[model samples]
Target: MNKILVLAAHRYPDKSRISKAAIEAFTGLADVTVHQLTHAYPDFQIDVEHEQNLLRNHDTVILLFPFWWYSSPAILKEWQDQVLTYGFAYGSDGKVLHGKKMMVMTSTGGSAQAYTPEGYNQYAVDALLLPFHAMANKTGMLWQPPALVQGMNDATDALIDNGVNYWLERLQELRGM
Candidate 1:
């Protein structure tokens, strides 16, 4: 089975409902590590070498976060900026992530309808995630379709649990675990 690294980034852990539920669903699952970015670097200061080492150890990487302003939390962006250095995560000499699988696992406060072309956001989740796909391509990693939980702010406990189960099932299916 492929080892999975879940890089979770939440702005405020105390106020997190979806992120907490998602993490709980994956707890104790074999070959899975839930690394919380906010907890790891509270001050937004990232350790590039350490982050890269974690990447090198995982077979599949899942970026889990709540969509904020149509993008990831600032800390995740900072982590990306610092850790994904040239000649390391990209460039001719950057082959550490090559052939590995990667995907986004996210939740959005807005309803699914709001993310459509004709909706409020005027773009689908996949469209909003094009940059991630591009990053995966640049690094020679296999890009998997994202797993998302929509309308999270309005989601009930049962709905959140269902979303958690859905994500867990999808990940297991991907790894045949």
Candidate 2:
């Protein structure tokens, strides 16, 4: 079974709706660890060594966050900047993340239709997330297709429940990969 590590990054986890539900669903799963970045590092002081250790220990790394400005929240970016170092993630001797699988699971306020060329955002969610794909490639990790829950701003309880269920199902499926 693949040990999965979910880096759940939300700026305000207390006020969160979708992200909270997703995290709750991820809890208590075997071979899965859901690390809430905001809760762990409210001051944004990341422990690089510990983060790297977590990466090294897990077979699959899932980046869980709410989409902001067509990208991840500030803390997620900061975590990447601090933790994914040159000599650790990508360099001559930096292959700790090699062969690991990466998947982005994000919730967006915008609707699915709004994330297209003919829509308001004018770019597909996958296109906007190319940097993550490239980063996975650079680190030698297999990039899995992103799991997105869109139309979040007006989502109902039922919709959120369905999305959370789907997210849990995907995470459960990763153990077999």
Candidate 3:
């Protein structure tokens, strides 16, 4: 089975209703490490080497975050900026992440309708996440399609649980590949 690393980032852990519970749901799962970026780097000081080491150890990487303004929270961006350096995540000597799999799992507070040409956001969530696909491509990681849940701000507990299960199932499928 392929080991999976979940890099979860959220702005408010205490007030979280979706992302935090999703993080908890993955607890105790074998071969899966759900690393919370907010809890790990409270001051936003990411340990680059340690983060890189974690990436090196995992075969599948899942970036889990609450969709904030159609993008990831600030800390996740910071983690990428710090950990994905030259000669490590890319470039001639950077082949550490090559052939590994990666994908995004995010909960958009808005409804699916909000992410459309006729909606306020004016684009699908996938369109907004093109940068991540590019980053995965640049790093030579296999870019799996993202898993997104929308209208989650008012989601029921059962709905949240179902969403979590769906992601877990998807990850399990990836592990076999």
Which of 1 and 3 is ahead in lDDT?
3
lDDT tens string, model 2, 139-168?
A: 999999999999999999998998898888
Which one wins by lDDT: 1 or 2? Answer: 2
lDDT of 1 by residue, 18-131 (tens): 788888877689999989999999998898888999999999999999999989999888988999888988998999999999989999999999999888999999999998
Q: lDDT for every model? A: 0.89, 0.92, 0.90
Per residue, candidate 3 scores C-alpha lDDT tens digits across 39-150 of 9999999999899999999999999998998799999999999999999999999999999999999989888999999988999999999999999999999999999888
* Residue pairs in collision within model 1: none
In terms of TM-score, which candidate is strongest?
Answer: 2
Runs off by more than 4 Å, candidate 2? none
Candidates' RMSD to native? 1.2, 0.7, 1.1
Model 1 regions lying over 4 Å from their true place:
none
lDDT of 1 at 170: 80
